[model samples]
Target: MELRCKVFLRYCTCFAVIGALLVWPAPVHSAVVVIGARPYLERVAKRVVEILEGRYISGNSLPIADYVAPIQLTDKGLSITGNVSFHSAFLAKIDSIEFDAQKFSEIFLNTEVTVQGALKWHGIGVVLDFAANLEEYNGTGTLYVTYNQFDFPLKVTKPFNSTEPTGSLQFMSIDNSNKIVTVGYPNNKYVQLISRAIMTNFDFRDYMIASFRNWNFQNLLKAVIDEVPFPEVCYNC
Candidate 1:
């Protein structure tokens, strides 16, 4: 009886400890909004820019950077915020040909992304993938976004038809060439460029661009951080 009682007492103690851990509230939701540029999102955007440019973008931070949101922890779901947009998504490609045009690229996407998982709390980044079309050139690549120091690798390819050597589509007027080549395209010419390049039933570049514009992880995270009910990590689980 004595031995049985001891074993029972130990079992009860273990259960009590387990109960404390289970009932413990998930630390708390912490979010912050930064007016200045954020490093993680910047890295993601920079990678996107590099992919667009056909070469790695120079500098650690984009010349123009906007911060949106931070990661959010909530009972309902994990929500993140922020958006980073560039004036031009152009790559410099020169040919010894008749026209002297600076290669500029832009992306548009319609993205609805919501994910739920246990975060390491340190840092991790995940880059989404999307199809791409730069003027007449079409391809697929990844958008590398990160969180808490982890890098997310996303590569989306665009399978384009074997188009003629020459094709024309309107481009964003981030540079002078786009202004000159505006015809048969809407004033907001993301449509024209994407339409001509993909040459398929579905448009991946535009879709991805829309997704990146609204929730490029960094911006979403920034927004979440900003909207978080607390600053110093109330429940930093």
Candidate 2:
């Protein structure tokens, strides 16, 4: 009878162990991001640029609330005479500048990549003293659009903000299979200045541009990027 009791207790212990194993959660294994991280990132950047270009189609106008004159003119009367005007005036749209994906430079893994494009502000200008019209501005003859930073919400296991590259790939994990990617405005001063300068120099040179300085180009770019669908990339099957 004692031997039977011992066997029964051993069976009960085995059942208990099996039951615990069944109830416990399995260990989480990190996901592997396929290679081709750089190409994927560049594609994402190009899509963002396309969205921005589309957002400001020719004829669509936006308000210039804080339009400031780049040069200090005390007594000279300034006026904007275009499809768009200034100082709470309308900002007339021009032709979309083509984004050159070939020149996408300073690529930092999946962190950032800069685009080269030209902004031609034709028929858009300020009339000084209601006399001389200044109607053109160019940055390196081509605007340098840098996709300042990117984030991976669906692909990354954890929230990450570091720009530094990691591992043999030399870039952050970019799941080619993932469908979504996040892009943010650049924090770089040169980029900010150039963006603002473009607006001030040709788009809104006559009005108090400083008053409308809150109109952030970065936010505009981010909004534009958000509207476009994330580009898809496939590699290694």
Candidate 3:
């Protein structure tokens, strides 16, 4: 089942080249991200999730895809902070993951919600990026077994290339139970003012760093199911 690199490349070539979709001038002093209306937020969130999920789930059969979450904001009021977890979900167990779980397993998506990111504007609409570490995702059910696991991290680069709004995230230091995924913002004055000019733009300077001070062994559970490893793959086998 190991796909040769050339074959993989040819097969994967069938899919579109993936990247962000935004282009824009540098930050303007008067530009402030305003939270869109509730309905707008819902629509934008759905579109964003679909873009990401589409790429991961069907585009190329990525290791993890098909993201699911609730439909409400976690906070009481409109979020204009740093980031907000607008939705959430709980699966029966983490051990049930396969390369094509969405095509097979019956996964349940939760409708819980949370928020934190600034409700900034990107010309097209409101934006909130949650560049944080995930907490324990314990599995719970009456007609099932018992398990404990944490949700995996799925970082989003700025939407399409229309804004040219580019940012980078990197895994910084790690502690006992946590790991900090630093999202650096080079051009945002708000981020610079907050981080004291500590973050490096593409370097993930001080943009957004989700700290993980304690990491469980399960957090590192990555399954490599490929009989052949390559940058791309063809499934004509």
Best by TM-score: 2
Candidate 2 TM-score over all chains jointly: 0.29
lDDT of all predictions: 0.29, 0.33, 0.24
lDDT of 2 by residue, 1-237 (tens): 999999999999999999999999988665323344435444444554465456633333233352323422212353322222122233333323333344333222353322222222222221111112233222121122222222211111111243322211011221121222122124333323433433334443323333223333444444433443333322223
Winner of 1 and 3 under TM-score: 3
In model 3, where do residues sit more than 4 Å from their true spots? 1-42, 52-55, 58-60, 64-163, 167-237
- Candidate 1 TM-score versus the reference: 0.16
Which RMSD does model 2 reach against the true structure? 16.8
- The residue pairs that clash in candidate 2, if any, are 66-209, 66-212, 67-207, 67-208, 67-209, 68-208, 68-209
User: Candidate 3, residue 42: CA error in Å?
Assistant: 4.4
Worst 10 residues of 2 by lDDT: 150-159
Residues 167-230, candidate 3: write the lDDT tens digits.
2112223122222222223324233222221121211221212321122212111111111111
- Model 3's TM-score against the true structure: 0.17
Candidates sorted on TM-score, descending: 2, 3, 1
